[model samples]
Target chain A: MIELYDYELSSDAYKARLLLALLGVAWTQRYVEYYPRRQHRAPEFLALSPRGELPVIVDDGTIVDDAQNVLVHLASRHDPTGRWYPQNDAGLTSQVSTWLAFAAALTPTASAARLHDGLLYHHIDVDEARRGAHEQLAVLDEHLWFNEDAGWSWLCTVDQPTIADIACFPDVILAEEGGIELRTYPAIRRWTDRVKAIPGFIAMPGIFPA
Target chain B: MHGTSRWFPVIRSEEIVPRHIAFVQLLDEEIVLWRADDGALNAWENRCPHRGIRLSIGTHAGSEIVCRYHGWRFASGSGSCTLIPAHPSQVPPKAARVRSYQIRERYGFAWIALGDVEGEPSLPELDGLPHLTLRSMTFAAAAADVAATLASEPGIVVHDPYRAVWERMGDAAPMLLLLQPESSAMTTLHAVAGNDLTGAGRLAFLRAHNAWCKEIRPRIVSEESRSAQASR
Candidate 1:
């Protein structure tokens, strides 16, 4: 059995939960109070993750930290059809890895703004974070717009969705909490709707089902 | 607004697919645009009358739009509240309905009129020509200001206060552009290339125009900001 350390409000943790449900894998959630209690930074929790991230999954004594790594690990090991990770094709694998790295850039910008506005993390420079988020979103919108012309639905130039879609979903969907309106990014908005329509899709606190 | 009675292009026809809620703003009024599965086009006030929640964030359930907050369902054409999931047995009041606007599809674009519009959207330049709609872009400036700027350019022809048209030097097809006033400080541009392009040609044409839009957006935004600073 796999044990996932989770916080309900953490989008990073929700990524693991969403993939788990999509894969139909059995797992047990170990709730860790992230806000106010600050249990993620505690010594006991530091032994599992030194950087104090909310999501750290343990599967049969193998521990995986970081949201992107956990996604790659789960998809590589569990997905029988090899559609999610696509590690067999070198070109597709490189493209997926590139988007995974791009998804990491959202944490400090979009996620930081959300933290400052919604979670009382007043120490963050929200305006700067918001500006960075818009820049990133514009790149995403342009890419997705061109992808539509090629008749590709996902992030990569593939018919099926990859881990890149899952990696970027939570931050982009919950961007409104950070005062980031998606009205200008029409392609990105449509992509989010397509993502929500995927089979076995789940919602978080701010994101609604399609 | 004084221009409320006139038609303004809000979105491309293909963009408003069935079972999806598209949000747009016209002259500072938020609107929810959706197409029914039965091919009915609807443009309504973005707010849910029950709690003022944005209907743009609601679900498009084939023939109706369901408010995300309370699960209130409003039907397609009439905007009438059809069902209240909390109290399904009771009939909803007649007044419980969304305010709808006039919308018509013309030349591959969705033209919306916020007030009492007289007739269908008539454009002489388009005259039933084949066109490829480009991706829409929003600029941080007033619509009139953007239109005025374009009118001053060398080759661009200003058809009306809200419309413009231009052509590449040797190309047979003309590019017709429409301006949508999202607010006093924001404007969105919807464009169509008057040509029947397909496959790679369509992609290339769209990309070229998108690049042009990207170049112009910053110039307009910067000009607006500079003028705002001077006025202050």
Candidate 2:
């Protein structure tokens, strides 16, 4: 059995949960209390993830700490068709990798704003965080707009969603909690609907199933 | 200065599809724009009357928009509070209704007047031509400044404070530009060209106009900033 260290409201953890749900994989969630208790920083959790992140996953004997790594692991290992990671196609792999890095870039600005607003992390400069998130969202929106113009639905040009979609889904969907409105990014808004409509998709807190 | 009583173009008609909500701003007022299943368009204050959370982030059910924070539902057209899921049987009071603006569809755009208005919004003449709307662009400058920049372009005629017509230059087709005053420092420009040509010609025309708008946007913003600095 796989073990997932998760916090219910953490967008990072939600990414892991969403991918696990989409893959139809059976995994037991080890709930971590992020607020007040700060269980992610506790000694036992630190043993699993030295970086003290929520969403550390243990698949059999292998341990994956980062959310993106966990997504890659699950998709590469469990998916029979090799669709999610798409290692076979070099061009698609490059696109997925590029977006994965973009998704990582989103966490600091978008997810940090969410942490400041929703979790009362007052130390973060929420104004700057929101500005950064909006900048990133504008770029993503333009990309999706052209994608729609070319009749593609997912983040990449391919018809099926890559792990890159799962990587970027949580922060963009929950950006409003951080005072970042998706209204200005209509294409991104429509992309969120497509992500939600994926087979075996599930919603975490603040993200309703569409 | 433009008053809140006058109608402003909020968004293009094609932007707000069924079951989707578009967020719009008019003169510093945040507005939620949505199209109902019945094809009726709605323009309401973007806040849920319950908790002041933005209704723009909420879901658009076929007939109503449901608040994400609390499961409060607001009806389309009327903007009346229809249901509170937690309360179940209890009907919300009349005061729970969200404030709505008068919205009308004209010339392929939704026009919203913040306060009560007496007559229809005046629009430029594009009634007979088959037209294509260019991608709307937002500028970090006042609407008046953006309008001035557009009017200054050679062969362009300003119809009014909010509308302009750019005459054909070279192979480019004649196009209309409409400005929406989002706030004191922000503006959105919507463009439409007569769809006299089809296929590659139309694509090239849209590309050319879109590129031109993108090129001028930064210049307009910088000019506005310079003017502000000079005034100071």
Candidate 3:
């Protein structure tokens, strides 16, 4: 039995659920409350994590901590025809790699952006990161080059939305809140639509409580 | 402690510790790290200056710190106005502030930067490395500087495609670099499971990492040295 531990609104958990929900995988969930502030520090929670991240899952007692790992595990489990992960496709591999990198790599920037949007109008200190994002986005934007023959693929060459799209789109979709306008990039906006059209797709919750 | 221009990295992150109240390292600033006697990481500029508090001395008492001196309590990172002593809120913002760095925890470490940063700092890469217990270190260089150091020499040799790429697919590479500035940086070099990676294969990867470090790093430094010599 697959037992999932989720914290309701966490994107980390969402990545896991998005897959399970689409695959229609039956799993029991245990919701943990972590919002009283600093609750993750509780020994019980820290015990589950050495790095202390969330969206961890247990497959018959084997604990998976990192969210990206969870996604890969899910994709592999459901990869019947090798659609989600095309073994022959480095395009898919490299594409997926970029987003996974963002989710894990750009986290520090995301946390700062949240505060920037919340407390101050200007995000003065993270300019270096903004420039960094621009570089990353440019690369992503270039990869997103869509055409009649090659159009709107979600982080995969299969012409379908794979976990790769699921991974990259969330943070990029919310970039506007951090003063990043996704609308500025045509390919990004188009790719966002493709993800929405996929089955078992759930829209990102609105900011300020939806 | 090197005192090389103490930098209070701006509010570069949002989450510090979900449980323990701890302060992250600021660029070079003398940061006050403490838990509000409660279990929260509350950080401030580690200077008291009034009678010179060294703010770290205070502990959290429900989102407020009781200045060990006479049980004084101040709310917020601004270090302003006491609630316990019921001091007037007009304790001028300047006198009350302990200066706090915005902190966030991701991957496995807590990062705090001083001042208001522009936008957010994203998570770094995690694929390609061994997911063993990660030991990270930061030097006085931006991610871009390091990336430049790495990019100019994209020299990496994989022992086995399965081990380096597929088997350790989820693990980020040994050098997941992002260039941020000229100098001052953060790079997480991870080592994965040693189970399948035997002594020889693992040693090979290590040798590659060391060689990459040795090969590229010195070139830039030498180039800089030559330039400095030429200028002199």
Candidate 4:
């Protein structure tokens, strides 16, 4: 059995939960109170992740701290078809890697803004975070528009969504909590709908199942 | 400002896809537009009555727009509050409703009448010809200034402060330009080209006119700003 050190409201943790659910893998969640109690930064939790991240998954003897790394581990290890990680296709692998890195970039701006507004992290510079989020959203919107024009869906050129879509989904869907509106990015809005319609999809607190 | 009873074009009809929300601003009022699966069109105040969050961020669930904040769902056409996810067993009160505006689809545009309206919305003459609606573009200049600039172009006729008919200098079919006043300093232009041509010809016309609009937008804004500075 896999044990996920999870925080309910954390978008990073939700990414791990989403992929785990989509993979049809049963994992027990070790709840970590991220707010008020701040259990994620406790000494015991810091032992697992030196960076004190809320999501640290321990599967069998292997342990993964970062959310994206956990996703890679699950897909590469468990998915027999190799569709999620697509290790066989070099081009698709590179595209997925690029978007996964993009999702990491989103954590500081989009996720930080969510922490500031939703979780009451008053120390964050919310204006700068929101501005960064909008810039990223514009690039994503343009990319989605071009994809739609070409009759393709998902973040990459593949017919089925890779882990890249899952990596980027949480923050873009919940951006409004951070004072970032998706109204201007109609293409991105449409892409979110496509993401929600995926099979075995589960909704977190902020996201609703389609 | 025109009378509140008049209908204004909020967005193109194709924009309000089924089960998707379209957000547009008209005369300083933000409007949320959606089309139900039953083909009913709805225009509302773009806000959830519960928490005043913009309903444009919400999802369109076939017949209703569900607010993202607290899962409050507003029914299509009526804009009445239907279900509160938190209180599933209890029915909501009659007063729980978002203000809905009268909407009409004419000439490939969604026309919204903000206040009490009388007759049908007046639309530009297309002579019952098949037409193609171009992508709407926004300009930084005021509606009047944009309209004035377009009217000054050769073979262009201004019907009013917000409507104009343009005759291309060559063999292309004439087109109509409708200006939507977004704010004191912004305007949106919607164009309709006559459909006498098809295939590559139609594509050529659309690209040329689209480029023409793009070329004129910055010039109009610059000219208008210069005049405003001189007046000051």
Candidate 5:
């Protein structure tokens, strides 16, 4: 069984919980208080993950830091079909890595805005974060629009969804909490709906269940 | 000027995938558009009557739409409240219903009439010819301003208060522009090409037109601002 350092309201932590549920892998969560308690920065938690991120998975003595790495680790190890990560296909694997990086880029912009608004992290420059988020969202919307034209549903070229979709789902879905409306991005809105309908998918604090 | 009485394009027909709710606005009136499994299209006010929550965020259950809150189910077409999970055995009140609008599907676009509409939607002639729908563009300028600007452009074949038809030169096909007034200060422009395109041809057309639209948007918006400044 994997032990996850989790925070209930943290979107990064929800990424691990979502993949674990989807993979049908039982995991125990060691809850960390991220907001008022600021437990993520605690020395004890920082010892496990050097960056002090909310999601750090310890699976059978092997430790994985960061949400994307945890997703990569779980999918590659547990999924018998290998469809989630698709390590066999080099092109698909490269595309997934690109989107995972994009998801990480969203943290400082979209997720930081959310932290500022909801969690009272007032130090974040919300206007700059919102502008950055919109720029990235426009790129994502165009990509998804072209994907729709190509008869593809998920983010990548493949038919089914991969870990990339899960990685990007949280920030996009919870964007409204940061005062970012999705009305302009019709394709992104539709993609979020598809993400919600995924099998074994669950909603976090601000996201709605399909 | 385009008034509330006229029908306007809300979305492209191909964009409204089944079991998905599309959020659109007409003159600042928010609406939620959804399609049923039986191929019926619905446009209703974007609020759930139970709690005034946005039905746009609700779930589409094939023939019915389920509200995200309180598990209220409203039937298609009629938009009547059919089920309330808290009281499954009892029937919902008569007033428990969603306000629906009159909608029509034509010319690769879904059109809606906001107020009391009497006749068919006024549109340019492209009925029999196969056409391609271009990506819609949203602008900060008013719809009337956008329409007037498009009408003033060269090669205009036909013109109306809210619709414009222009003859394109070279590889680009004839364009049909429809302006939808979302609010006093916001508008969305939808376009359709009067040519049947497929495969690489279609993709090329889409990319070209999309880029061209993006290019013209800033000019239109800035032009509006300049005119407003002049008037002021």
Candidate 6:
């Protein structure tokens, strides 16, 4: 049985979880509730991922820390003729790759901006991190503008869900808590809703009960 | 999540340049983009705690960030509700603040987040290669579903795609997959370089790749059960 660390607010963790569901892969979600104390840096959590990040998938006695790596492993290990991952779709692959990188820029920036804005109460003001988040959103806006009316289904196509959406969806959507208005970019807003419409899509934790 | 007036980057900061308003996207919530008068940037949750009117959409009068719906002004630095148009004589409580974020400039750009994180986000390390800004679009699937599609493909050209945008460049950059979940939004396309492929040639290769994505990425049929929150 595959086991994943439980995290209510981590989009990275969702990436792995979603893959397991798509494959009907049996797994357990272990809640790592470390509040009032940064348990991610603790020894027990550190054993899972030295970086103390979420979406660490433990499979076949191997612990995978990074989110994309876990997805790749699942696809490589599970898919026979590679249906979920087509061996030939280069654009979809590149888009997924790009979106993952984009997530790196958007997640912390948006969340941090929310903090500087004082959206959440407890943690904040570590050198004003939110500044980077808004800029990141602008880049996304530009991308949306470029293809606003293309009617492209996925980040790469119009038919199905791509790794591109999974790679970037979690953190981008969370920007709302930090006071980001997602409605500005029509394409982004539409795209986000489409992702949400997907079956089994989970919501990020709100700015309470943490 | 994508309506124009519904989610706008309210206004540039007095100290912030026009080309530099951060996109504060709230998923089904009001958004207000703000920058400081002293280059100390701050974007607030569009909803004001007192009346739920947007504070970031309004103009700045003196040091306060005001609301457009009503002339309620909150101090940008502290998010304190300072002025009430209906009751100008009243002194609002300390909690009369709009949700806000820490904004700053870095790497020829600005970033935002919701907490006092331990450190700034480090950029992704990549294999050296001239980059190409491939198309960016959102999909109707989860990051896992998307990643599975990419990994499912051992090679980089999926013909008969769903809907892809192909660049006209002729060179093909080696495919490198990076699923960075920390930063929000959907997938990112990082171009890889291998051998003596010309820039144009690499672009062509990417174009083919894009075509595959738009044409053939899997159509995920999600289930109807809500699980606990997770990541990309």
DockQ, all models: 0.70, 0.42, 0.01, 0.21, 0.74, 0.02
* Cα misplacement distance, residue B105 of candidate 1 (Å): 0.7
In terms of docking quality, how is candidate 6 classified?
incorrect
Per-model lDDT = 0.88, 0.83, 0.51, 0.83, 0.88, 0.53
Question: Per-residue lDDT of B27-143 in model 6, one digit per residue for the tens?
Answer: 333445545556456666767687675453355554666665666777757888888879888888777777776554432233444445555532323235443333333344544
lDDT of 6 at A181: 51
Question: Judged by lDDT relative to the true structure, which candidate is superior, 4 or 5?
Answer: 5
lDDT of 1 by residue, A64-161 (tens): 99999999988988889899899878999999999898888999999999999999999999999999999999889989988886788889988999
TM accuracy, model 5: 0.94
* TM-score between candidate 3 and the true structure: 0.43
lDDT of 5 by residue, A1-210 (tens): 799999998989999999888999999989999878899999999998889887999999898998888899999998998999998889999999999999999999999999999999899999999999988998898889989999999899999999999999898888889998888789999999999888899888888888
> Model 2: per-residue lDDT, tens digit, B74-185?
9988888899999979988899898988999876678998777879965445667666776777777888788888877888898877888888767345677888888888
Single out the weakest 10-residue window by summed lDDT for candidate 2 chain B: B122-131
Error of 2 at A32 (Å): 4.4
**Which docking band does candidate 4 fall into?**
incorrect
Pick out the ten consecutive residues of candidate 3 chain B with the lowest summed lDDT.
Answer: B157-166
**Model 1 native-contact share:** 0.42
* Candidate number with the higher lDDT (3 or 5): 5
Which has the greatest lDDT?
1
Off by over 4 Å in 3: A88-95, A115-129, A146-149, A207-210, B1-232
Instruction: List runs of model 4 lying over 4 Å from the truth.
Output: A36-47, B1-6, B47-61, B64-75, B80-97, B116-232
Interface RMSD of each: 0.9, 1.9, 18.4, 2.7, 0.8, 11.7
Order of models, best lDDT first: 1, 5, 2, 4, 6, 3
Deviation in Å, model 3, residue B118 alpha carbon = 43
Q: What local lDDT does model 3 show for residue B114? A: 58
Candidate 4 lDDT tens digits, A5-122: 9988989999989988889999998999999899989998998888998689999967888888888998998888899999888999999999999999998899999999999999
Please say which candidate is ahead in DockQ: 4 or 6: 4
Chain B TM-score (each prediction, in order) = 0.92, 0.89, 0.45, 0.91, 0.91, 0.50
Candidate 6: misplaced stretches above 4 Å? A79-84, A114-128, A207-210, B1-232
The lDDT, on a scale of 0 to 1, for candidate 2 is 0.83
Docking class of 1: medium
- Screening candidate 4 with a backbone cut-off below 3 angstroms (N, C-alpha, C), the clashing residue pairs are none
